[model samples]
Target: MRGETRTVWPAARRVAGGLALLGAATVGYGVYERDAYTLTRREVPILAPGAAPLRLLHLSDLHVTPGQTRKFDWLGELGRLVPDLVAMTGDVLSHQDSSAPLRRALAPLYAFPGVFIPGNNDYYVPKPRSPHHYFKRHPGGPHKGPALDWDGFAKDLVADSGWRDMTHVHDVLTIGGRRLDVRGVDDARSRRDRVALVAGPPEPGADVVLGLSHTPEPRVLDAFTADGVQLTLSGHTHGGQIRLPFVGALVTNCGLDPSRARGLSRWSAAGPDGAQRMSWLHVSAGLGTSPYAPIRLGCRPEATLLTLVPAR
Candidate 1:
């Protein structure tokens, strides 16, 4: 009886160990394949929806490395959703020299009307540092600003893709009876932006006005809101890149509170009666990272789908 009991015990222990190993592998796969698996949903309000609902696709931060055709294919798949208009809020490429690949990746997006703004990464190359070195303080925090030539890059992009260049400019377009006034600025950290390029007290006839920026700095958002822009889109913070389960994102690069760092939030202005008039602010968690900094822990990159619901 003792020998038979011992034999059973060994078999049970072996099965338990095998199960544990399998569990570990499963968890590892879940984390590694997170990018391909995760999709986040966020709905934003469009004040005056025209005859039919308009779907807008917001794509941001494709920090592409050279030879990443797979990433480009994923971007092309975005068209499958049939967005009426698309907005790109910067960091389209990791290196200024690699703009060609970013252009190629965005070629599929040209099927619809698209507007673009550049992030610091596109114009200001981060100094080379160790793989996990982003945690360490920059000691001086980059006294010298972004070195890229904005005019040249903007020109090349326009010529190459035929997309509207929203760098320090404003333009209006009509989409199904709704007029979209787009006001955009260059990266704020570098002071390359000038609000005057797109300044105005909102045109009386437009349904909505969009304010664009790579970083959602308070001053920048204020400028647009003061101008009566109804909505603002930004994507400099990678949704804190690594988010913890219930606690959410660890850090947002800007001054925005962590809760408002990545999704739909409300920005309001007070009227004569002291009632708050609000607008929708949508920030994408972004799609990729700089080639040098390649791993994203808890946050999966995103392409936001903002469906315009008429004011109820």
Candidate 2:
């Protein structure tokens, strides 16, 4: 009996040590993936025949801190692209001091015309919560935290940077010498999106129409589809934040399905006649994670450069 006990104890220790090593390695790798900033290039078919392609840069979920030099550097590098338009589907801040870093990171891109809408994180600071609650009871509307200075940021964003703060607004602007219709609302996950106010078909004869939201809730997408929006850009899922090999995204953290957590997918609203009105939807995996839960697995942080082409 004594000899058998000794053997079991030795084997148990070895197994426990192996598990500890694996856990440490997993955490280290997750951190590495979080920092792996990447850019995804895709083509958006949403223009008239013979119309020139408009390069659009979609940015989201910045969640910037006071001095994240690495992220800011990457953002600065993107200025070289000189895209025709930029869309900032928000969550642009995670810390009280994030505004400065956020401004520095995006200053380069501001040179181009852009549109923006706020995300939940933009208004409230991210707070740590029980892991299970991340899926079961993730926050919405507002939670306990210090407020971010979004007003100051928004004011300067329009007056100084020339970017349009498109929250809850519908209007037309000229881009690429063509009329582009844009409509966007406040963060939908927080129940702030008042889509009905601006709900309608694209401005008559507008060359292109686009919608923006921080969260890709199904109802919002349906509204955009109903309105004939050519393409809609959004973020807030963080590409499920943690992905797996074949399983892909485990959770969307929003009403969106796991499969469409990131990248382009067709969206539509059901027509009364059992028809589907399809519209283009591009949900950026986004460039940063919530400051409280700063980790990534198979999912890398990202932005997307969408080149609008003529639909066949």
Q: How many residue pairs clash in all the candidates, one count each?
A: 0, 0
What is the clash tally of candidate 2? 0
Question: What's model 2's TM-score?
Answer: 0.95
lDDT of 2 at 70: 90
Off by over 4 Å in 2: 137-142, 271-275
| Best TM-score among the predictions, by candidate number | 2
Once fitted onto the true fold, the runs of candidate 1 whose alpha carbons sit more than 4 angstroms away are 1-41, 49-51, 130-140, 143-150, 269-276
Q: What local lDDT score does residue 171 receive in model 1, on the 0 to 100 scale?
A: 78
Q: Which 10 successive residues of model 2 have the least lDDT summed? A: 135-144
State the lDDT of candidate 2 residue by residue for 252-300, as single tens digits.
7788989998999998786545567888889888988876678898889
Model 2 pairs whose backbones collide: none
What CA root-mean-square deviation does each model show from the true structure?
Answer: 5.9, 1.8
TM of each candidate vs. truth: 0.80, 0.95
Q: After superposition, how far is residue 194 of candidate 2 from its true place, in Å?
A: 0.1
